[model samples]
Target: MPKPAIFWDPAGLELDSLGSNSYLRSTDGDTPYVSLSIRMLSVDTPETHYPGRSKPARSDEKLAELASWIQEGAAPIDDGLAAHLQPKLETGRAGTLHGEQGEAAHEHFERLVEEKLTKPSGRKRRVYLKSGNEPFDRYGRLLAYMAPNYTRAERDEMTPLESASFNLLMVASGWAASFIIFPSLPKHSDLCLFQEEGRKAVEDGLGAWSDPLTLTGYEFRMCVKLHTVTKELMQGKKLSKAERLRWIDRYCCDMSTRGVYSPQDYYRVPAYDRIFIWKKDVNEAVARLNLSPEV
Candidate 1:
């Protein structure tokens, strides 16, 4: 499936002239007319396109087994995570649950954007965007954290957490998972806040967390990717060194270890310890973090 799209914008010359300062024309230097996608920073909502019949297909059944194995690998990070996913995996309904939660997250997210960006008079306001440490992701999408375009004085009225970026709010509200990656990890103060919010959300069983089977967006995508290879491995097929290395590069990163690992070793890294890094960004991530992958 194509990558999901959200928080994308196409800024016109008029808005740029009005000082929105979106500089949406980054992708089109000569024309100054095109828009680009924005991959919101530090949060990931559920997968919206995973097909589901609420009953396991042969493929779904296979994926379920593979997912369970991956969950076991992640058990060291948080035993509760694998425990939480167990019921749905056993019933072969993991994919269906993911799709359902994805829909719920989408609807809630839409309402949130409307509530945050609409003036009481019903006119819409532009969202506030702060670019990430890196300007763009490997997908060419701008990476940003968005919030209401409140003035500094207006924002001062609210507590910092209340005024926090929608990215953090999404995690606080439990509709999305905290997904901060290396180099984009915020300063200590803000990082503490995000962690607190995430802990609270999980404790409160809010949104998708209310459903024990819900997979974070990253986990959902990983299951989709690794299932096929996992199936081959299960059948006793051996990968050549190049293939093994390629799959490992594409497959493993752990949050707890803050290290990249081979798929066989990836499960040892623990859940929530996994971080997202695109293939092209691996070199940069390695350089920035001084990582040594488990080859």
Candidate 2:
């Protein structure tokens, strides 16, 4: 009973037998530009070469076989019959055998990039104003939210337009985070409100957070963390009072400022109950305001 033969898709490479000096062609019509053989350099012994088989070999199996052969110090001969075959031999020894697997993974990664690029916007635009300068207001909010500790000089260094854009992006990230963290909270509607507010903030010449790339990156992490928290919450596992307070504080800070802090910061600032208070205010505001458009 011979083992079932497995095959790999050889994109464009060939392997020869141990003794016969014959050219082997890959099933995909790819002919290697070289021939390989096993030889005893001490004596003028006849070289053995394996002609390429009609079908591809399984990648795993091919790797195993290649590993065994390399251990035997096989010499490769280029089809061009060049002076040396060191490059090809080195390539084989380095395990460059699975072209098909590489191709498949590349395709999958490309699809993911395409999906991200094609995401659609689902909210109405709204503008907010502050200090007779919409851009400034938006930027102020963004800086306050994102890099609160930044000095006035830092804020002044940014152009009004840039600040507004940054703030809008920060708002977008917050809305995106909410969707992932609380899927049941009418995400579409919240997004609409967020967009409207962001636009208003921008139009009023208020500084708005700009920088979709940064916001997207932050949202990516937030979504992952939110999923973990949501699953734990749904499990009916009671969080300790301290744990619940910590989560509340963290969520508040993230929502209000789009800022994240380490666990050490959370413990150090137990005195700053403003986060807890602000969280309650925001929750109440969301509840009172019919922000979600009826689906």
Candidate 3:
């Protein structure tokens, strides 16, 4: 019998673009680029491809206030454990935010990927993509909590987001937002961890949080063109009758009469590229319409 395919591999790795968050992989020893886009799970960075406009400067007082918020928002722990774990929890504090700081983050990520995964200098390093439950995002991107530190057993034991996740690092360093699109998904555990990191970033006044003009995650997502479908879904707005019907046909959308179902019950809807509706939002839509599940 053949051995199980290992999750981490260092073979045939090539990074295409750091700005768009894409890379190439060939674990099967085939040609790379077979996987076009590999998204860092649970976070979204500002557009390095298009740096739109200047953001306002954040006040020093504001930064201090934000940092304090992070320390307070940390999850509750036993007093005995809290004192000991406090230093470890602070590990995430020493990070750099992506777009907020400069285009440096894109270059930083590229360099990190090269050093950790592609470097053939000594013993080649292995990178792992932990596809916690929901393997693909609605955009068809391979949604994964990436671990360049997979070789470290202690890091592997930590939750992917809590460990050395390229995704969470972006958020922790203030490079990205804790963009929790599908809150009800199995990756919620990872999301929670990323959220904590994001709070730390905010508290530390890292990245976009330091920019007065930079929007909060909710505000930014609502305004971004990439998140149109998500904004519409969350705001209880409909594009058209036909569009609604199509969504129903594709994603089992019974928005007219909120239906209750597990988030796991739904799969990727083929019709839409990056459309996603939270299970609770769908249920609320269903109840709002007072329509039966059949609708």
Candidate 2 wrong stretches, greater than 4 Å: 1-164, 169-240, 243-245, 249-279, 291-295
Query: Order of all candidates by lDDT, from best down to worst?
Result: 1, 3, 2
Q: So what's the TM-score on candidate 3?
A: 0.45
Model 3 lDDT tens row, 172-230: 77766665444223253554555567668777778666753444332222223212333
**Per-prediction backbone clash count:** 5, 46, 13
Q: Residue 10 of model 1: what lDDT?
A: 75
> How do all models score by TM-score?
0.68, 0.18, 0.45
Residue 110 accuracy (lDDT) in model 3: 72
User: What is candidate 2's lDDT per residue for 83-187, written digit by digit as tens?
Assistant: 221232234321222223223333543443344333246332332222111112211221111212223574498643333322223333322111112111223
Residue 171 deviation, candidate 3, in Å?
1.2
lDDT (Cα, 0-100) at 158 in candidate 3: 65
What is candidate 1's CA lDDT for residue 19?
A: 46
All candidates' lDDT scores? 0.66, 0.29, 0.45
* Predicted structure with the largest lDDT when compared to the true one: 1
In candidate 2 the C-alpha lDDT for residue 92 amounts to: 30
